[model samples]
Target: MKWSMRIVMTLTISLVIAVCLSLLPKMDSSIGINSPYHWPSNRIGQVTDNNLPDLLVQVPLQMRIRKVELSSTRMSLDLSLPKNADSTSVYRDLYTIAQTMLMKTKNVNQVWVRVIDYSGVSDNASTQLVLAMVAERESGKDMDKSASELSLIQLEQELQNRFRITYTSKWQQRYPL
Candidate 1:
């Protein structure tokens, strides 16, 4: 009888210890403690840039875009256009594309579209269109660009087209808001 009692007490103690040991890891994780033995450093964190969502590839392919560079808040696109494409039409198309593609992205608030000549030569000519998130979000009634602003973009496009001027660099970063 005495031996049986000791065996039962021993079993109880062993069961309690087993249960506690099993729960230790879970408790540590719930409280934000990482166990070095169980958690691998590389597997436990956020994905790096190389593994970012496939938006980078999908955006260019879907839009017939030539090149795309994306950061947290801004995206720059290189689009191939005919040598003498109409400035207004090009701007409209670029604005529409930028708005549609980027507005829904989680953190993107601005898009820079560069209309490059079909020749793909840096010296040929390009038109740049920059769209801001705030302006895009505003009601259509309030979203109109000033006449001068519209004319300025048009003029720049015209000058570049006429002179076959191109920027030395295809991509330029705009100041962050």
Candidate 2:
């Protein structure tokens, strides 16, 4: 009887551990909330934060960046993704990356992101624009601003307030946003 009780307790503990282990990767705490869509980093350009000023860049787990530009009020990035990235997920990835950039540098009022086919870059004017978007910050003129760390929920709310991106595919984007 004593051995059977110990066996049952051990089995219960083992089951609990198994269930917890299985859920760890799916937990929201591992990455930011809704943060699963950045592109793969092994494609074309390996990006670093050398050129960006007043901002620090963190490429989300799988994404690679080709070029980045920062101006007085805007941040622009040319991201490289898998050649076969899914169409539906492409926009989501771009949007999430854009939001991440904005969250990282709360001072910037705009972020422009695009994916261009690296193989076609010899013809700079004609590179295919797979997917592109621009997200502009929308803060109430009346609200007080501070340098506190931005929460993921706040980032989502900020994206919900951006102006519509009407003309994004002009790939050689010159910025003065």
What digit string (tens of lDDT, one per residue) describes model 1 on residues 1-177? 999999999999999999999999989787653422232222322222443333344322222466767676656667765544444554455544443433434445555566654444555354443321222222212323322355546644533342222332322332221
TM-score, candidate number 1: 0.35
- Top candidate (TM-score): 2
Look at candidate 1 and tell me the lDDT of residue 67: 72
Among the numbered candidates, top lDDT falls to 2
Badly placed stretches (over 4 Å) of model 1 are: 1-64, 120-177
Model 1: per-residue Cα lDDT at residue 138: 24
Q: Tell me the TM-score of each prediction against the true structure.
A: 0.35, 0.44
Q: Give the TM-score of candidate 2.
A: 0.44
Instruction: Give per-candidate clash totals.
Output: 0, 1
Clashes of 1: 0
Candidate 2: which pairs clash?
A: 39-62
